[model samples]
Target: MTLYQKLKASGNPQAVAQITISLLESHSVKETAKILGVTPRWVYKLRERFRLSNGDISACIKKRGPKFRMPNRTPEHIENLVVTLAKETNLGSKRLALFIKNTFNIQLSPFTIRNIRRRYGIHCRKHKTLTGSRRFATDFSAFEPLQLWQIDAKHIADQSALPPEAYASIFKNKLPPFQFTAIDIKTRLRFIAYADSLDFKNGLTFMLLVAAWLRAFGVKHQLFFQTDNGAEFGGSAGSRKRKLIQKLIFDHWNVSLLNIPERNKETNCFVERSHRTDDEEFYALNLKKVTSRTSFLKMAQNWILYFNYRRPHFGKNMNGMTPVEALKFYRCFYHPAIGSMPVVVLDQLSNYTSLLFDISSLPWDNLPRNKKLLNETMAHYRHSIFSTSL
Candidate 1:
């Protein structure tokens, strides 16, 4: 077979371009077209392109389709927005699509978003599967807001996840080293506090503050706070300190502090999962912006507010609702301020001697009548002591 016939069978663009260039040089357009088993019009078009490219062989190759972009193609700006959101949130295609629609009022299919992610080599990290037996098969789907909360402490000074500037700033500015996180399993409402250390006192203080904040916001249900058996949280079974702290929380707020089984992370999965998000969305992005402990708390407060009031959660049973929205959807009665609860420094709160004394001495029998007093007291600390310290 001839060169054209050989290449026509394979349909190689480079080979066709080379053959077209060579044949056009030695033969007329019609003769070249006849030899190449193509139309004279095609030969004429190739010759014009070749001449325009100064006899470049690549210019002679016919593209597989139209030269112009498809009319249905996503806009460049939209693609750029998608990429920006992908890097910022690291969310999956479906979640990303939902966010775009909700935030920007733009509609995009998940498949289109997935294609954009694939094209840009962006990928969401895959989490490891839980292999060991779960301690409880309890379905949390039926749980209501404040009925179940998962609390955990996460070290925020991770060198690997933080940028060098942020890592240096952590020590330079004496920023809090640990973050105490609490998430309501039902609405995914989260609260956070920072601490200089992960000691038992700080942990107990954090739990009490979270409980007080919840109760202040009309969360009157019996709250269950689940946590891993960390030393800060009273340690494993048979530990005296753990029992003491548990009793303190139970006595103060009627909150039940349940310790998850040792070595099984899946039990406290909600709070544990929130840690990864904290690393990705909060610490990694905002740490460098923190010039002082005050600034860090401000940023932390804003971040938690954004998470609860604005950011959409697409997790199981959440259905693309923000925590605040989820509360409303579930018909759970809660104050809107619950979503914007003040972020406090645990060490500061723990060390406030008079405040601690007041909390401990407050009459539990008259709690209903003292609700306004309790709210005023905490608000005073948040505005006066916490503000001054910051």
Candidate 2:
């Protein structure tokens, strides 16, 4: 038995108390044993342990052995194989545990796999360190409104994080769940579309939807569309056809292309971080409500509406303002043409402008630094535009 187990299994609370007092008092070993009603050998062992730990009582209680135990009673060779697979896949703990169960018939919980990952350097952080030589980084802060956009897709598994009926629908051949996301880097405006499959065709369709939506909203701005080296976004996919995305960005939308470095997902950290936010705030909470694909689609649409207009974001540019507020602020502060455009554009933005829409009303210098974004969120005060649900 380990030292801690042996010490705890003895069930002698008074013994440890006596040892602590003895160490603090600098009592002799004989005096400590007599005070604690234990043998001299036990006192000597405790003293030795205490001295080894440099007078730390808590460290003295810890057992000297391996910290990690393989999950699901997995064999050593199989555990090694799991680590190897982790090195390749870079999956999260629960996904890695599921992989182990499906591939080797070993049942491991997410917590166990997390411990195993911490024990050995098998996590994706190690993957980042592996390629820590040199690479370019994206500055999500440096872009102006409509200066850059990011688009990406996320996949929801067939039988993961759903109810029983949701589980029963996997009949070996069906369209899986996927979501196409587009984000404006400056204002953090997010648009999302759900699809059954991931392809360049879907990428084109989503970009067209974004362009059409922007056109309908009367927004005219040049931007660069950026994506990683994924096959979906016309990257280094080895001749799988990328002309659709190229035409969608360059010809139709008139946006430049910002290609991310190979194997460096952190370069696209904004959208990637937002995906985790969606997973936690939306997907995990709505698992029970999602009964079918249609319901899932509706959920995604509503989430985008909330994300765009309701949710408050805080940053250097978007301090204490929603995406809509941030967008209005940038346009009002930067673009005189937008202010002088047709009354329709002014009307759509009037809800976000201060009373009278006068430049004199702008308290840019009078207001504190933190309150400078206030004039942008003020409406016409005649009606609340966001009263109706999207």
Candidate 3:
């Protein structure tokens, strides 16, 4: 009900009028509503009644201010600065604002910088390095480097507080380094580097670098690059990368282009999970000290190399081998069977990683005649499997 209605219902009209006047004067509709135990709309109605009763108050009340203003300087220049800085270093609002203030002599609040970002609709995202939920994870297994590659990019956080040199030179321009990473799922060899741009050229260069690294390490196999449908992975509709992969890679190698469905593509689950090591080992220790992108990237590269070659992946096999060892072991002399499908146990997860083998690969003579036995054969691998709902 309106405050007028409330007052008319109340025995004390003068007291209600005084309280309403106090609330309108103080702009404390929330407090007044709580005291009166009424909605703010009722308070608003009271203000409108009083304003209508006194024409002088309505005529004197000023108009509300504008929500946005045309930026004093060129917005193009600021956008360029923001994009450059975000790419070179992952410094968020407070630092960006302070950097502008100290270096360019332009005093900007963090909120203003956020507004500037919103104005242009520039999004800067850092994929989280850890996973508490397994919803986005993928299921794939092939025990060699070229069998499959999981790819993604991460923005490395700038951990250092404002240093004099950084404020003077780098921060003045708003340039930060971006980290692009690709991981071979089977062998777990990582291709990680800090780059200034995330363009098609960079994507091609990253792939070439991985191919070169594999060749240099005497790793030879038909490569199957599996990645999300990121812009970098595939070019714009009917673009060069799309043509290149279709005409060249697919025609040449035993390529398998696997991607998470669009709905599940938001999180880069496998490689993102690998970033936990990047955080615990690299960023956590070095963030307090390093400011230069060059220095930080060098350290990051070294750590990633060590992780791929030395660090043991507890998830690969029940035998507990590093990814390299497991890949080599599988490649050299492992064979289960050729008839029906082999029972590949997934000991770690409660769920099944069902294999749909090519019927063409096996002989018809040894194949299962009974569908029930085939289903039971697959189920018997996992002790916890309750049904063949898989």
Candidate 4:
């Protein structure tokens, strides 16, 4: 039979693929197309499509009609039951179909139930499944500052309505809404940077900034950066930015990168909890204030300061102290393995320095003269008297 007759009889993409393969083995594209009664361009297109789809024969098929539909033979009462269970209990299609079979003595396929739910726009209905997740205490945060850091980014809605500028093409302005975040596990001290976009490149940039900031505090212990297995973090495709990070941050600074299990947020519990706090306190309160990209960024920086230095963290470890307070606690105490640092005071300007840290990053430059120096003689020598409160 002719090639057209063969394709018409089989009426399957696989058949087309098989015939194409046979023809290509013995003939050129032009000859194959001539034999098939189609243009040579069509043959080349099919070849490319096959290559891109990795020779999946089904890729050659013409797409057929109608994605979703409730079966016509299904009774109206069964359809109603599917919708009712979906809305009330949020049972899945199979379970709902089984319920219909048992209670109403009606046999409804899961497909029929799924189609019925889809018809009423309830197909995406979800109910919580029993999981092993629970609130639990962990001893993983016993390290000194910079020994461990958790990094992650959260996305907010883009509220900007303005159009692009004329010179914005080469360096075009399109700001994506993302809040790149990092936290010291032991101190609960955090770093949050707002950015217009978030990708692997942006993630690496945030890490560099965070490391530099941490270095300024003299907390330059070899650190482990824990993050989820996101494409941006773990790296994917052509530009494996994670590899570059391994060479730059990990190799250079003696830091390491770690990935928690896929979809296992609990493994990266500290950052996840901080994100919840941001949702409750930051985003919910300031969403309306984010009129422009610039304004939103300023607001985000303020929130980060409040979170790290002002807002108290609750835990036995934290002792109702803010993150900076917790850091002071750690600097005086706590070791990686042996536990608790020596309280060796070299009698530097720590009193003035620590006070400077508390004055807020932005306002420190504009602070009154009296606040910058030791107005009072604060002693920390061995002979110096110590005071404590119960």
**Candidate topping TM-score:** 1
Q: Model 2 shows how many backbone clashes?
A: 0
The candidate with the higher TM-score, 2 or 4, is 2
Q: Could you give candidate 2's per-residue lDDT for residues 183-223 as a string of tens digits?
A: 77777778776555566445655655565556555566666
Clashing pairs in 1: 234-242
- What lDDT tens digits, residue by residue, belong to model 1 across residues 1-390? 765678867856678777888887789999998998888898788778888999787767766777898899899999999999998777888888998998899999999999989889999753333345554455866677668999999887877766677678888889889999999887899999888888877887888888878888788878888888898877875676666555654666788778887778888878877887877777767787888888988888889999999888888788889999988898986778878878888888897734654445533232477889999999987899777888
The full ranking of all candidates by lDDT, starting with the best, is 1, 4, 2, 3
- Candidate 4, pairs of clashing residues: 168-172, 176-196, 334-340, 335-340
Could you tell me the lDDT of residue 93 within candidate 1? 87
lDDT of each: 0.81, 0.59, 0.54, 0.61
Off by over 4 Å in 4: 1-132, 135-137, 158-175, 236-244, 332-390
**Per-candidate count of clashing residue pairs (backbone under 3 Å):** 1, 0, 7, 4
Tens-digit lDDT string for candidate 3 (1-390): 755568657875455656666766766888788767778886777677777878333433234577675557446777688667654545566656656666678766677677776766655544333334545533555345445677665555434323244334434333344556667665555666555555544544455455545544554666655566667556433454555555654544344455555645444566866665565455555554555545554655567655654555545441335555655666633221111111111121112211222223333233457978978877786645655555
Model 2 is weakest, by summed lDDT over 10 consecutive residues, at 338-347
The worst-scoring run of ten residues by lDDT in candidate 4 lies at 337-346
Q: What global local distance difference test value does model 1 have?
A: 0.81
Evaluated at residue 243, the lDDT of candidate 2 is 49
Which runs in model 1 stand beyond 4 Å of their true positions? 1-56, 64-91, 120-138, 353-390
State how far residue 234 of model 3 sits from its true place (Å).
Answer: 2.4
